[model samples]
Target: MARIKPQALLNQSKKKKGPSRISISTIVVCNLVVAVVVLSLVTTYRHWSQRSRNTLETQSQSHRFEDTNAASEQKSYDLPGYADINTSKGLITVELFKDASPEAVDRFLDLCQKDHFKGMPFHRVIKNYLVQAGHSQSSIPVEEWTSKGKLRGRLNTSPKHEAFMLGTPKTKGNNNKDFELLITTAPIPDLNDQLIVFGRVLKGEDVVQEIEEVDTDEHYQPKSQIGIISVILKREL
Candidate 1:
């Protein structure tokens, strides 16, 4: 049991406490550094995420606006230059030769727009010749069409011959006053100058053939009723 010096013992205790303090200080500094690094990383991630979300939202809004504008433009566009004749059999679309016969086209379009052709039967249908319609006397009996003197009065007795030529001005004699529309089933060169050829059948030629095949009397009047339901006129943009 040797006795230790007091100063030595005090020095030893001081050395032990110094190492403990150094260790504690080092641990506290390391923890602070780690906390600061973690906080910086979290802030950077939050900022990047916010920016990415905003960019996505902007892109989505731009696409929606473009689609809406395109749809609006499409809705505003007008139909192509054509007339739709909806008949009992099917729809017949005709493309008018505006350059060839402007007046005839105008008169026909006027009748169509006024709904004058609706419910009017194809009064005269001649197989391999022509199909005649637009007669106001459609509801009347076949004999009355000519016997009542209505047909005699409505005849274009002296139609303008110049009307057959392209770019010819419309004359009072060549106007469609009787509202008679003739669709030639075959190439009848003799009728070229007599009847107003404003439009040609673009679609539904089969329907024309069907109408021509219908049973008819000696007066060329359709035995079975065949009428136009409606007419839709469309102008090209």
Candidate 2:
């Protein structure tokens, strides 16, 4: 074999070096692309996880709030007695406490048994408060007379205004009478002693208020007739 020339040897060396340069550049570019892709995937996964957790927390908090509010408005009783009064305004239902005020409740039941309140007008009403009527012929007071049928004692008298007595509770020495109407509210001082507080308007207080708001004459008669078509009470045997 002839001795290899120096220029030929140099040319062979250049050819070998070209492949190494291309391989090194390719390796560096591939590593950079891989690093960028990995960082992007990590960022996206973290964002998605945080959003999911936030949504779950919000829904849980909303449910807790609604549960608390609903419980606050709910009312129930141990005794099982109810009165449903149908009036021109609408239906006004009441759940009474017979065990708490037995005598007064009995009096009310007696009147209901007699059909006493049928077709009676709601004689009185106060806004956001009560509508009252039970002025039957029997409720009218009898005048006093002597044994000879002559006017005796005071000579002239009026029916005892016991309508308010039912709205009142028992005092230090008195028992509350029965057969009247009342509704509850934030509580009032005058009502503390005078009203028997037989029952509350469980629903349809808006109708009560509507009756109260109607224009009244000097005697407190509503301009529009608001009457009790019927009164019903039910008790479990």
Candidate 3:
């Protein structure tokens, strides 16, 4: 071969170096592109996973809502019936728990059906606490007894004064045997066994509290007689 000049040889070396540099740059660019693709895939996967989890959670919440609504509907359908006792002081509405306490509810319903609560004074009133009422002595025997003669005969048949006493039971343990109403606030002793709470005052708690606040005599009877004008039961919800 003919001898090449040093400058020509240097130029040839530079030309070779340029291709190597271009190759290295190309390799670097390819590696960077692959890294970016991998990063993009990872980000997409993470986002999709998060979205799926959120969607599942939302679906679960929707199911729970449906279940809760169904339960509420069932409860509304099954709720016990209520009665309104229109008192001189105010109105008292009670939801009868016949399933929880049958005898108690039956006795109360019997009296209410008879309209026995007309013009009966609340016998005992305790401030912020309770009231005991339903006495045969409030009105004349004729007026005291409800128009329905069924309960009158039952009560009149009893020789004992306690038997006819409203809220007082002939039997010692059963409070509901008679119409002896006890205003319930604090926990009463032996209440579950000794007495059955047949009714609850839904609206006249303020009236009960007012009655309770009034002064009582030595017998704990309210100074002012809080009378119940009438107590009626409505079957409609």
In model 1, which regions exceed 4 Å deviation? 1-80, 136-177
For each of the candidates, the C-alpha root-mean-square deviation to the true structure, in angstroms, is 14.2, 15.4, 14.4
| C-alpha lDDT score of every prediction, in listed order | 0.66, 0.57, 0.59
Q: Model 2 over residues 1-237: C-alpha lDDT tens digits?
A: 899999999999999888544588899999999999999999999999999999999988988888776664342233346777788878777666575665566666666778766787766554433455644321211221002234223243221121222243343442223344544322333333355555555666666666667887765457777787887886542
Q: On residues 50-149, what C-alpha lDDT tens digit does candidate 3 reach at each position? A: 9999999999999999999999777645544677767777776666655555566677777767776677777765443346676732222222222344
TM-score of each: 0.50, 0.46, 0.48
- Compute the lDDT for candidate 3: 0.59
Best by lDDT: 1
Clashes by residue pair, model 3: 126-212, 127-212, 166-179, 166-180, 167-178, 167-179, 167-180
lDDT value, residue 2 of candidate 1: 94
Q: Which stretches of candidate 3 lie over 4 Å from their true place?
A: 1-80, 136-177
User: Residue 21 error for model 1, in Å?
Assistant: 99
